[model samples]
Target chain A: MVQKYTSMAYASADDLVFGKAKFPVKAGLGLEIGAGYTTPEINYAPRPQAGKSKEKLIKEYERITTDSMQRMVQIGAPSVVLETEHVEQMTNNPSWGGEVAHAQKTIMEEYHDEYGIKCALRHTPGDIREDRDFLKLRGDKYDLLMESFEQIAQNGADLLSIESMGGKEVFDYSILRNDTAGILFGIGVLGSMDMEMIWSDIADIAKKNNVVAAGDTDCAQANTAMFIAGGLLDKNLAHTIAIVARAISAGRSLCAYEAGATGPGKDCGYENTIIKSISGVPIAQEGKSSTCAHSDVMGNLVMQACDLWSNESVEYHGEFGGTSVQCWGESLAYDCSLMNVALKTGKEKGLRDLFTLSDKYRDPQGYVLAYENAYRVGQAIVKDGTDNYLRTKNAAVECCTILDEGIASGKLRLTRFETKALAKVQADLAALPDNSDQFMSDCLTKYKEEVAVFRPENYGL
Target chain B: MLDLKKEDIDGILIRYNVSLEKEMTPDEAAEELYPKDELIYPIAKAIYEGEEDDVIDGLKAAIDAGKNPIALINDALMVGMGVVSQLYDEGIIFLPNVMMSADAMLDGIEYCKDQTDEVPEPKGTVVCHVAEGDVHDIGKNIVAALLRANGFDVVDLGRDCPVDEVIEAVEKEKPILVTGTALMTTTMYAFKEVNDKLLEKGIKVPFACGGGAVNQDFVSQYELGVYGEEAADAPKIAEFILASGDGIEKLREEFHKH
Candidate 1:
């Protein structure tokens, strides 16, 4: 059905690149970061905490925002969206308006001062009200929420992003097409975003909104979106493809901003650029081993996910679907130094494996098919290792150990969970050639040895 | 590829068919269509196609002819269902087709069960649900359908289920594997709650969590929690749980081993 629109979205999507937004696009080897956070304290808040005085809340945000912004600069982010300052509201309670406003001001001041980086602030969806009709009726609170974005925009913020519970609300708001100046809306389909409700209107909303919509990192949500978009597969294939589509669709400039939650000890989402690439359409991922153990895992994930595409294509269509012009094939990597910065022994082994392998295959067009083929072989390894990965105690420890060794050797760099060992690994890996086979092979041998020791047979599968 | 003639429909329908279309009680059809050699593939195909009338008549004819329900289910109905699943997976078919196929398969199976007089062992009950705050259940539904087709007795808790309900199911059913799915961060933590509650209760069921908001790393962090990377991972987890012989700690330990 042809969709009717309600409002104009003023944000210009012309500046928005598909894959990696923050990182410059390098024809040879591009790197972009996945920036943002999902602080659980906000989600698992104290009941009274939700109603914390704006002054108190803004103070807390001030501390968090300062750190987050500083980290963005340190990590080499070209542009950063100031994390949303507004919290979901509870009805008939003390409002968080005061704190949210203060946080907004703090972010604005910092962004204006730090002109080197592009800044965007997300609009809060406001408190959960059972009155579904409130927004339609232009209820006072709903009007206030819309006015909040205007206030943010008028206050000299570079971009205004509207966040809701999911896409359905966005569709209902008719903002995707609003395309009004300085205003944009991004939808998150992952985690608690109503898939069925949102899906019914998403494509139309996207078309009407004409605002670029962000796909999620959640495998199921992405898969559901893909299926609704015309791809079909069993549950397993769906999950795998969801990651690929979400990443690939994002393209090179904004690969890191592809929506997913990241925080300490959360696995529902992955952090590596390689997993992001392989899981979705191919694109270059930036940063070093932030959420992964070694560069090899990025290569491993990319190759494997690519293999799923290639193999599935051949099985059904009898020919590998080339990386179409629409799909730019690039290697993705992540920070894998989170596991350890302390244990000094296996650091070099992990670093060498990642740098050497990824460096050799960094060419986007040259080795696309080959990468996919190698990934198919890796799938077997993943399958075989499934039993080991499932182990609660020994397996978790072993995986952590692998992460630690890579970080120490300078091969893996986990941004969120930093360790001293990672710096050493990064320094070592930086010295290696971009494509040295001999160096890679030596690294692999050492990795095998480390795996033998750190992750003994009994420890894994 | 085997082309059985339309006339062969007599044989295929003799043992299985949807009773809604055939105007026969499951028991009546079972007694009359027993040992029917003719009613195999066609009846199964009819069920897969959701040919309600044809399926009912076919079951009765097959049963009257003395065909075993298990054989008909395995050879025809199951075969057709497999084809439907493959088609659905390949995008050749869709969700409605699968639901229709499942409905047809179940109708014939019911007749057979009625005839057998012995209850089929619930092939390892599994507790499955979407996590709290996560309202999307389409993915979960697909998993449920596939699991049921693969011979699992699924204790489906439906969409947007609370963590407590999931824990209660684990406590009540003692399923070999309990799974939680969340499509959003809003509800993914419900998995953690289930994991914590089960651990608290000393029930060591393998907890598999998957969906858009779920990640293997997060699942690995929790005790007794095995992050299901996909919906298909559920059956594999169930297999592991059953093989462990109710070894909950072993299951937890095994999940973390990766």
Candidate 2:
């Protein structure tokens, strides 16, 4: 039987019902979605080939765009948000005024008519370096943004998620505060923020305008508090929670994404995860995506992500040969790490209930690990290798060692990363009589032995 | 065949840089342990690998057979550490193997201490640790293991060491070199405190810093700092101090410019 969305999906008040736990009770899982739009890095593939004809170019664009959109949808995602671009030179240099209008009209018609889904036209408010660039607030350049939003809204655009600022600035700028009000039907904040305030404001603004309100932050548990605080609509909260929860739990947020940029994806995709996850409310983790080169690599990644879901409804992001896994994994780790936070915050049950709902509707394999048609297997492995291996193996090894010793020593059984930490302390105490080197050797041996128990029977012939 | 006991292999790794294929016989293992020409190594790995049928008899027999203990220690054990160090840098060896090799090397060192008439002074005292908030200490542990294998006195602070404790140890011990390994951006900042405080008090202990989150740019940017590119680089850094007559400034001048 098809399952209905959890009551948490519809419940919102001072007494928030987050998964299994009721509010006015204790802390529950916190989740935020909103990563600002980022200009595609200059180096990604499918970028403009140096020498290509209009026909070839159009074909490539269509192939990439269609595949990406379909991948987004298959992931149970409601929409694919693209970096805003103009019909710079569409087939035959048609009139700028006429072409953009025509493009918007065609896009709206195709989204609802052909795909039975919605599309969002996003662009920089200004030159990406400039603040308020996308809102059409800065000089004449803002005209492009204003016109695009107007044309899309008037035509068939379902919702608009504007990149308010970089993750840090989103809280400070309060982009949803005033200036852009009434100019658009709905608004979403992309990037990091003070979650508690952001959620209250989103709720207030969304209610005032009679439109949906949403915002998202990076993988930090503090950031997720916004969602728990009634920061976004049900649809937005659900989607954000699932994506953030799964990413953090799997330890995907530790790897670096953008080259030369710090804090992993100080460049792009990181912020996009936040924004889209928040804006696509009630969708839960459906907004997350992972870009890799093949299916198997991303498949393993999706499985790992599924393991991270506190709410049985898993949230993951998959793309084939699209972006860097280093960036993707870092964000994923960040999401996975937040799961414990969700549990402690009293939302583990609600999140788990949502997972149950999600699992029934989708098979584990059906979960989206690729975007479009191309599948990336090996591409993501190395990307996930460095940071992912460091964190995951550390946890896994620690866990096994702790469990094995606890059993041998006749201690009560425990499961969870915390058990590993606790078991380590106990093991250390037990091994204190040995010299440091011997102790370390014993610890490592015990750890390996314990970990071997969890390993598959056929591992490493 | 590449099959071999992990710990026995661990010994050969300490005494010689060579590794055995799985499942080799005692004779074959001995042959693999011996040299072909010019006798660069003075002892065979067989003696070290041999199991004791009678502990007292085995020791007496080996001595009567004129197997030099120091020669065995230098050839089989130190050589193994050198090989392990190289393998570690090449990523062919991991922390556990390096550790096992270090342990074997230490066993040889302890044996030498017991057998010799006069004990040798340790190469130098070096302080090492992973900075606070940095839980990944495998790198630091590897550095300490290698340093110990090479005869330096290593005071390992283990993982998540605070800056004040590190500074107090430096002030009291005045170790020729104090190293901090941090694999997280958040934790790497503490190294700067250690570096700054040392320079502030006019102390000149060369601070060797390196790990995943740390880049050469960040290390060189700090005062009295030398960037250790790999765990193996620790011994090389220690060598500079021993050669420089405990002059940390001279060591830093030669190495920190990079």
Candidate 3:
């Protein structure tokens, strides 16, 4: 039997009913979806609206979640991974760690385990920067955050795709001041500096507790918030994607696309555009596309040749507009680091040059065409490929060359986004406590079978 | 990448280049950010629609062309800022763009001021601080910048400031208005601490307080406190306080019921 792949797809309530979405191809891999009350923004109701009662919120989760999981089974998903949280921590309702295990054991394993279908749970500690209560309290927040991280791991999640918030400054201040609740960072605030400090620190904490650290791109989240709700941020997709792909390439773990509900059109909706800064300045493509489009699907291939950026292995939901096999949508994060661009800015010449591939694949519909093509290749690779170590190394060398060419001429200037990314790969080599250096090796080891087939290489450095 | 001819390259640097993959035109973008009157079209066109050089070059050209410095400030610079404020208010632009615009606007303001003999005193003196123990001052900074943009003398005390420091600054500055921001529920209590101290000293200071954590209920609990729901309202509130003779209580009557 082959090991399961991490490229996940989801089952949305709206799509399962209206779209007649099929099950993601259960090549016996992970089936994950972004949804429900998993993100801070989605669960946290706007102020003055008086959040729903604990009972009502729980009932809503129950309704959406059970239907979603059942859709996985109906679609013949080989295995399922559920993303959830106990209660909306930002709200008045108080629930804690056990709900994670309960969901895993009851909502997930109970039904699928019978058919030898593996099931798991994913968790995003949903904390928004705008949440008033979240901004306060030093240690309780950390303990709560850690509690969720440890709980999911303990409850036997096949993969604990963790979500995080807070900057190194706040983390350090919290540590130095003996303040427990760290400063609230809107998601995707982690930078190269933060990775050097806080990310490694958290990685250490995760390692100590044997938790899997899932890395995600900040651009998808930032763009989603920018397009949907205006705020101050950088919306460059190429720059952000390069940074995230590098981070994952260097061993940050699985590419977790959590949050974002919608994206720019795959074909005719929004014209092909580059990622713009928060103030609406157009820069080159920095990271992922704004919506579920070709750039995003292509981004997965770019990362997958290195790490798990998209779920190759799931139930389909019609709502997202992704094709039937398995659908990995996008991430929804609101990053708040807009103060540093004037001194130096992110420039994306080479990365933009690489995304010319997305343009080339833009036949009929750019994003949709790419998405469909990627899954087709994914299905074939999963089923027919031979697992050989030498062959894997050969494939890895080719991917490395592809990545090298992609980033060879690119640079993200402000806050040193590109330089910092390249530095992270070399710096990881210096062997900080986070084991930043051994990430590529670890990727090779973790997916040796995949390495034989995918021939993954670290494009980060 | 751009493959632009001389015209296209110069095109972007001049007015708001309308072809940068955005749906709206530069003029429409400016109108949406700040929808006041026709006077601001030039400066707003430069700062919002045009690039950084576009903004600076536009201002320099105006000054060289014999436009009065103060008229430029009132009609163009300040008006452009009004749109910047509105853009931020309406969620049309985020902080990064606002900061970039603010920088461009200040650059113009400074150059124009150099051309004049006496720089006009700002609208009023308003002291601002983040409540003690709250390091999240992104909101407070936005308010202080807008206040400065509106020609207010802002004595900005950075975030996590002690309550005593707030009172000390109030005593020293004796500004027409004061503002405090708190992004944490636990730390917002410091707003009351500073207010009560000011009240004890019989300082009829106007303190407007608001942030992620401080609600209208929390802000209204103090004697001199007025709830600041939005940072964009800083200029108007300071103007109101100066006009109302620093009447803190009147803030509740005028600004509330939003």
- The model with the greatest lDDT is 3
DockQ of each: 0.02, 0.02, 0.06
Q: What TM-score fits each model?
A: 0.45, 0.36, 0.43
Q: How accurate is candidate 1 locally (lDDT)?
A: 0.38
| lDDT tens digits by residue: candidate 2, B1-100 | 0122333433322211112212443234435445442232322232223222222233334446675555545545555455555544543323434454
* RMSD of candidates 1 onward, in order: 22.1, 21.8, 16.9
Superposed Cα deviation of residue B212, candidate 2 (Å): 3.2
- Candidate 3, B127: how far from true, in Å? 2.1
Quote model 3's TM-score for chain B: 0.76
The global Cα lDDT (0 to 1) of model 3 is 0.40
| TM-score winner, 2 or 3 | 3
lDDT score for residue A237 of model 3: 18
- Local accuracy of candidate 2 as per-residue lDDT tens digits, A1-461: 11111112112211111112211111001111222111111111223231134454344434434444444444443323332222223212223323333444354346546665434332211112122112122344334444444443333222222322222222211111111111010111111111222233323333343323222223322122122212111111112122222222222222111111011111122222221111112111222333222111111222111211111111112345342322343344345334434546765444433432332112111121111000111122222333322222222233234334433543222222223333443443343432323433443354234322211111110
- What lDDT is reached at residue B245 by model 2? 61
Residue-level error in angstroms, candidate 2, position A423: 30
Q: Give stretches of model 1 more than 4 Å off.
A: A1-64, A71-79, A83-101, A114-118, A124-223, A227-461, B1-37, B45-57, B67-104, B107-119, B248-258
**Candidate 2 CAPRI grade:** incorrect
lDDT (tens digit, per residue) of candidate 3 on B132-166:
65556556767887787667878988877888988
Worst 10 residues of 2 chain A by lDDT: A22-31
